[model samples]
Target: MKHTYTDAMADIETLDTRPSAVVISIGVVLFNRREPKVKMKELNLKFGKKEFRDEQIMMGRTVDKETVAWWKGQEPDAKRIFKQANVTSMEDALNKLTAFLTQGDTNYLIWGNGSDFDNTIITSLYESFGMQAPWKFWNNRCFRTFKGEHGHITRPPEFQGVKHDAVDDARQQARYLQAIYAELQKYNILSYKERQQ
Candidate 1:
């Protein structure tokens, strides 16, 4: 029987991860492949100035100048959330994300855009703050891999909301995955939820 999952589509905007990367924002959407509804959450955080300067302290997590320059090249709307005046501390953001992930008893398959991007970065950030990641390693999933496998499936049009905003990105990705699953069902390509009794 093919396994199905209760997915948490997650995205993060960050300054690059060379020596040290700082998270600018996070977005997550909780949904089950077998279900149609979704629940979304997001956070915008302030980077620590001291950590930004200390190379050793930021080992394996440095922000790249190129990434910063690329961000500047993005559209104004894409950069709008980062410019918001009120941003939460990393601790506060992590706390809220933790609460959101563990709110119910459901086991989430945390789907990041790539294997080493959102989830990995968030885990590293949590460890830097002396906190454990909310989800387990076994729960990590890669949206890019799924997309690659189903490249023929047409995705829904890009969402009109803020492009780089975490919450909007997560919601859009979750909806896209849901649509793909629905199409798969319609064509009888795979009975994702069926057991081979």
Candidate 2:
């Protein structure tokens, strides 16, 4: 028999930057790939005393001017999350995310939009705070590569939520991955042995 389940999947959202990046939020969905069940958690962080200012860097977080400008072109719902009231401090957010990531003892495949984007930014944030990231380096996975190889995977009809909202994005991506994996299995394109690796 072959393994039918993946350990877990995590989707993170961040403010892109040079040198270092600021993680705006993290949304993780813990699930068994064999089953259609999942548990979700999200953390929203306050990067600085105010948005897009030197205070973020003074607190050891990086911000980029171009990235700020780019955000202006995004959807309004996507932009609203950033200004939501009562966001937690970066330290508190990190701690909560760490707790969320360790809820299960099993090692999980942490899926990010790109292999180097979300996970890299989070790891950098951990280093800046002098804390160790909960997941190992090898546990990182890329959703983009999977999508590219599999072609456009669509979201389930039930998920009518805003994109760029960390939790919603994570859930949608997880569902798409599950769909893609199942489709591959149906066509016998992905063998059990290959999947186990």
Candidate 3:
């Protein structure tokens, strides 16, 4: 079946019984997407909901620019900074994400676990921004990765250990997806047999 945000939500209802299509994780590290094996030239996104109320609740709690910079052990690269239009509000965040999806040459979305909170936030932002969500692609059909599971994939040994430290978690997620993509290629090779009713 085709994937979408709606299908993803339904899948979330089924939890372990369902697989996710796309995810909407927070933090720069959470959004990395890089090719497997090579382990170089990462892609990152910088977007998040900014409901004034949510912002208030998050202050002194959620990682802020300063805190994230400190954690990175350096200042944020200029290009990696979230654009002002995207950071202004939750609506802006959605607008920015939509632009990222449509304006870019690439056509893929990933999430470490999008079905849960990330999807919810993006869904809200999309509506608030007055856009028709490509619900299917966003729902049940995007790629995904997980934390602390069997058949585990690990990042470059240099990046080394895996932990929930949002940074490492995100890298592990990319590694997991790289492995899944390889497995899917293997499955594609067997598809002809499955189709030969």
Candidate 4:
């Protein structure tokens, strides 16, 4: 089996969970999930609220009232970028994420928390700029589906950060995916080499 140590997980905090949602923050972690001790590199970015979101809304992007209502009930720290952040314009954030993912000429297996949420929303943001997403569409993976199929890997690794802080959230999600993948490997249902395929 060929060894291709190319994998990444990205998480985003957005105003709405839908494809047209305005993204507030993006967190991406590069790691080898098969490794026993995960080593990660991170790319974390925040979007300027009024400057970014308002422009997107003017350009036909959307916000959901219900999602806003839900955010109101969450802990203050969960809304990480909302309080204070070194923010960038919408396009700049996307460019930074692209640069991070495409570095070293690696073909990354990009995984997002949900098949339809994180990746889809990010892709939409890229589309607004008329640019292709950094990773190939064929390389996209969904951790939500992976977890659903491996339900018995019930216990997650200890989470050590605010739930909705994008950087911390991405790191924790990567750990969870690694844990689940290790469990699958243990059963010999799929081997390390097979997973890289």
Candidate 5:
């Protein structure tokens, strides 16, 4: 069977780990589960520190003390986005993501690191803005779950950029997930042959 559906890996950097996390950055990469270049989109939100957290809290977003402490303990490189000069508001960022995800494709399988993390947070943000998420709910996927289930592949891609940077993380995730998909295809083909014997 020919594969035609588009797959994407979405990631976010945030101040909390809940559905209502105060999202600060987002990265998404659209690709086929094959070795090829991907279309990437990234956005860094302008953070006003206490003011920003208060504003998002007003809109029903959340923050966590441990997440804040974790960020403080990270290396300076991983925390660079907080110092970014060029940034967008959350509304504009979500709008751009919607445009990117829905513009060139129809059947999409959007992957997040975890089922309850990236996609959930993004969807919550859309709800905060009273807007619709671009991808269908059923089409959402969990890369963390897939990896945990079938992580038998021996080799994986090298890390590209700083750990906390959303864009770099998304690219790395999509590559590894693609490797897993290839391994599954190989296994399926072998299993079919065994069944025919």
Candidate 6:
């Protein structure tokens, strides 16, 4: 609704939609992305349930006395981060996210790893609900950040390894966005001052 075809409008259309983020992490860093500027909402998700019990199983390892303590020891710092997270079922989470996206004329879904796994989960959920996800930006855009060889770069570190905890991954993915924003600034794609208005 904010966009209109006016005399001053050019042929070029800048896809200025802000992206909604969903993260999944392990013992490593967090990942996330904010919603569109018009929405003024951010969803932060973290993961901390490291030790699986009798019914918990992952990566060919079963939850038992021998493995419980070892996994528990690896989870303290991550647990602290997610102690107050907004946890929900994957389906419920997708509903909340889609609701937020539909509030704006255009929106994007961003993840550090692109749409392979993260997008798959979300789109699959959307399909299950008999709704189509708005993911054109996700399919079209590719994120890239500069790596410093000699000088310092002011970007968050890259995410490494998989922990499969949704919240943790969101935080890590958020960093990649910061880098992308920085690159946009350097090339005059966008600026904080312009975005604020």
What is each predicted model's overall lDDT from 0 to 1?
0.70, 0.66, 0.35, 0.80, 0.75, 0.35
- Clashing pairs for predicted structure model 3, backbone only: 3-136, 4-135, 4-136, 4-139, 4-140, 5-135, 5-139, 21-142, 23-114
| TM-score, one value per model | 0.80, 0.80, 0.42, 0.91, 0.84, 0.42
Highest TM-score: give the candidate number: 4
> Tens digit of lDDT per residue, candidate 5, span 1-197?
22443677888889999999987778787777644444444433335345555667889998899999999998898787676523356566668888778866466688899989999999998999889999889888898987887776735688888887887888888888877767766667435532332
Instruction: Summarize candidate 4's per-residue lDDT along 55-162 as a digit string, tens digits.
Output: 788777888988888878889777546755464566777788888988886788888989998889989988877777988888899988887888566578799888
| Model 2 error, position 152 (Å) | 5.1
Q: Is candidate 2 or candidate 6 better by TM-score?
A: 2
**Ranking, lDDT, top scorer first:** 4, 5, 1, 2, 3, 6
Question: Stretches of candidate 6 above 4 Å error?
Answer: 1-40, 44-74, 77-91, 128-131, 137-154, 157-172, 187-197
> lDDT by residue for model 2 over 73-144, one digit each (tens)?
889987875665344566676787787777755667788778777777777877887889898888888878
The Cα RMSD of model 2 versus the native structure comes to 3.5
- For model 6, how does the per-residue alpha-carbon lDDT over 44-89 read when each residue is reduced to its tens digit? 4332223211111222212234333444555555434324334444
* lDDT for position 52 in model 3: 37
Model 6 whole-model lDDT (C-alpha atoms): 0.35
lDDT string, candidate 3, 66-183, tens digits? 5334434533432233221235554454454455444423334435355444444444434444565544444232333233332343343334333323334445545565554455
Residue 168 local lDDT, model 5: 82
So what's the TM-score on candidate 4?
0.91
State residue 11's C-alpha deviation in candidate 2, in Å.
3.5
Name the TM-score of candidate 1: 0.80
Scored by lDDT, the top model is 4
Tell me the number of clashing residue pairs for each predicted model. 6, 0, 9, 0, 0, 18
